[model samples]
Target chain A: MTLLAKNITLSYHQYEIINNLDLEINPNEITAIIGPNGCGKSTLLRGLTGLLMPAEGEVTLDGKPLQQWSKKTLAKQIAILPQNPSAPEGLTVKQLVEHGRFAHQGLFSKPTLEDAEVVDWAMQQTSVIDYQARLFNTLSGGERQRAWIALALAQKAKILFLDEPTTFLDIGHQLEVMELLKELNQLHNIGIVMVLHDINQAGNYANRLIAMKQGSIVADGKALEIITSELMKTLFNANTKIINYQHNGHQKSYCIPVGI
Target chain B: MKTRTILRGPKTNKRFYISVFALAITLVLSLFFSQIIGAAKVNITDFYDFFMAPNESAAQKIIGNLRMPRAIIGMFVGAHFAIAGLLLQAVLRNPLADPTIFGVSSGASLAVIASIFLISAIMPTTTFLTSADIPIFYVPFIAFFGALLATFLVFWLSWEDGNVNPKRMALGGVILGSIMTSAVMAIIVGFGQAKAELAIIWMAGSLYGRSYNNLIPLLPWSFICVIATLAIIKPLSVLRFDDDIAQSMGLNVKLWRMVAILISVGFAASAVSVVGPVGFVGLIIPHLAKLLIGGQMFKLIIVSALLGALLIVLGDLIGRSILVPLEVPIGAITSLIGVPIFLIILQKSGWKLK
Candidate 1:
């Protein structure tokens, strides 16, 4: 029902990056983690997804220890879309998406009719049905991101984790991907957790905001409560003027930088 | 049957079957022609008569003892080299990765030559021996050990931190293979006339008069390696993706990679121990198979083995009959064909060798 991390610590070699961190991921909520560079945002996401093992404490899913669960069973429950995943040359979008069926089949078995239908459904959900015949490398950034998301959807996992889902995209493409995540979260009740660099986009799109300074979470709540000028000054060392603007019948908070 | 049809695309299965049939026919033709047109002529009737009633006639002796064994050995060696190449290329994700390029075959050659040199060096000191009386047996066993050692050395050199970089692996293999081959050459140079000539012929991969005795001990290991490679294909396909993705999909990438490397090394070592390092079969045949067959891992391997068997059998048959008395070594003939096809492949596929 919920993925929870308790008193977890992460390290690379001798340097501990995430120290004594604890958090709970609520079901079906889009949680966006925002932090400056070297803040261990991605590392925390990796730990929650069971991609990286914590040095201390434990990560538990549905009241069971993450380590005790079999890898295949864990994969069926959680799917991770790594940043800029590359495929072999000449792989079409459909084929790349079809690879997500691997954990389900457990072998290079032939695709069943139900599997094919699910693959098609995944593509339809991501709206990349037109690009199914195109090679993955041939698409533009936005199209490729959708194709990758489609691949994640094909896994049919309840929780979807993405690291920097909009790092290299332009403003238009970034919003396209962001809106797709929100759509998936709303329509299918899939839990979406992502590490985003832009604080404003996270404020606009995410249901809950988790701001990290260095390795520990500095603030965790609704976007308006956590993204205040005081929190920005204390955590990010930035002097900003906080402005509340009405957009599309909703009051939104915006941070306008004044000086360093 | 359901799984196969589902796995194959609409056209790939038909092409696969047709290609396999073509390869089988080519194999039979090479066997027939090799047997019929040797120095002394033998016919299909002679084979039939020999099968029906055992005899000691010249044609029967040539077909049963020499030509038949030669053809069968060609098939075995070809399949070994090609499958080894296919496995290595898939694991390393490099077009140039192969047993010969990785120094496994040259290491075997070096070990075989060193053992001979060591024995011959000992002979002159003892009063009962001379350089002319060099023992020929036990070279294959020594070569097999050397090939295994060389394969691991290549793997060990390429490993950095926790990952194996494909480019570094290929480079390490090439450098090690060259050094071993040079050492083999230096050993050949140190010998006197008769021994040196014999060693040179063996090194060039000529099977002038080999028979069933040489193949008996090596075949089982080769068979086992081929089966092991097939068993690991599913994991291998998963591994062809980037490492993180494979791991996220619940695959133990390192474990599968180790299994694959062991399988490839097993294939290369056993083949080189018997048939002196035949050139280009491992490197070129896999690429050819990939070109003829598309990117299905299972079908690509099968086709590579079949085509490799066909190529070597045909090469050996041509070597036997192309020149009247002066027989071209099968290795030399394969190189000639391999180099041109390799050039065409590079031009057509237009893949960066990197």
Candidate 2:
């Protein structure tokens, strides 16, 4: 397994955050963790990245303990960008993207040709190359988020984690970020684990969906199989209707929740 | 497609280039002119003679022993304060944050004040080391401990529910710093003879009469602290993003924050020990540098250091030259010059509080 968690339990003081959670993430797939607010979705991603140690469990990446891996090694294998990343005033996109190469570049060594190439390619892939010289804070929310994604891509990690990448974006920008993630997964076969609030977006784009309620997974399977009306009601405490639609000549399933 | 491609190209290149060029020019001008502006007017020939061949004449003593050391120390201390300010501003994620704003300077000053007043009273016969006569090695050591105690106290008080909120942290620092500053003032007022001279000199922030001996002690410690900051530059840049985002990027947010704070405190402490709380260099230089060069850690460090060095050297020169025979304190000079420039920048930028 590229990443696996066994019997993971986490807590903050007396409140249990994640209780006896177990999961495995395969290579080259888009896995979406869907849940209502405060359902420990972010906490799970934190545990996977070794940011938060589970109270009573272990997370292993490539058969080695996650803690055993050095920060640089983990950084090279996995890149994550969370929601609403803040930058200091006047931070240019190029400079921000250059930070992703930190894990690969040594302290004394300057940026090599290959590092520059990767950074350039990452910017190109995310369509942020044109804004490379612009201050990050000056960009629109969507544009800024794209720059952050470009930074993560510069790491050239095989796996990427995103926490609510589309949170504050308008619908169009939301689609833009989603399309970028889809392209990264399809073109490079990168493993993607993202916490998504919008159930329809998750169902449409994710290969696998894991539904969580009150810090434990209630359903886990292929998107169509796991995102059932019963599961949606249990996970979100709302009645949901699943509908079929044709989008650009492709069949898509959309979920509409009612009576919160 | 063409429009999008063009939009993605380098946007702020012109501004960055101009700022860098300006910073370089200022550094050279400041360093060169500061040497000539001291109390005794030594011409260009005397400056060259002091540099090219030392001990040639007694006039060289005025340039070599006094002005030279003072200028170099000013430059180094200024660089340290500016870099520390940059780090603190980034860590707090607030533009207004500076080294003194976070109580680090006041912390060190309080410790020094206590050492001056209380330590002397406890041991009446023991000799108190003066900055000029004392061996240079011990100065930074005393300053480092004083700084460490103050920052530790700030850190301890600011911790609530296991997370450090930037706003609360700043408030805590301000409250503690004010308390310390008042205490130091009380001690200075209460002690009549032996403590008064040291207290007044430290409060005014003068670079006068500092020797190479005083500079040596601060050099190595400052170098280590600055180098440590360089190591964390990448992480710090990532941290500028929101906390969750930084963590997702595989940065250990809590650990990195602690590391940044520790290094910043060390730099501020060392600078304060030598330069005596030169203000606004820390508060304003980082913002000015950020405005000039975009906030890439690599570029920010270089530009902030250079700009800071330039400011201090200029402040020292103005302090010495403005009144001729009687010197103005370097701190007063810096505040007088820096505040106006800073306000202008703020006005032009149309900075609005978030």
DockQ of each: 0.33, 0.37
Q: Is the docking of candidate 2 incorrect, acceptable, medium or high quality?
A: acceptable
TM-score of every prediction relative to native: 0.84, 0.87
Kindly report the TM-score of the first chain in candidate 2.
0.96
The lDDT per prediction is: 0.80, 0.80
Query: Candidate 1, which segments miss by more than 4 Å at Cα?
Result: A13-15, A63-65, A90-92, A106-114, A128-143, A167-173, A228-244, A253-260, B1-8, B36-60, B111-144, B190-194, B318-324, B347-354
lDDT of candidate model 1 versus the reference:
0.80
Per-residue lDDT tens digits of candidate 1, residues A79-184? 8888888765445677778877777884546778878887888888888877676667779988988988888888888899999999889999999999999999
Worst 10 residues of 1 chain B by lDDT: B124-133
Candidate 1 residue A31 C-alpha distance from true site, Å? 2.5
- Runs in model 2 lying further than 4 Å from the true structure: A246-251, A258-260, B1-25, B31-66, B118-134, B160-165, B192-194, B222-239, B247-259, B320-327, B340-354
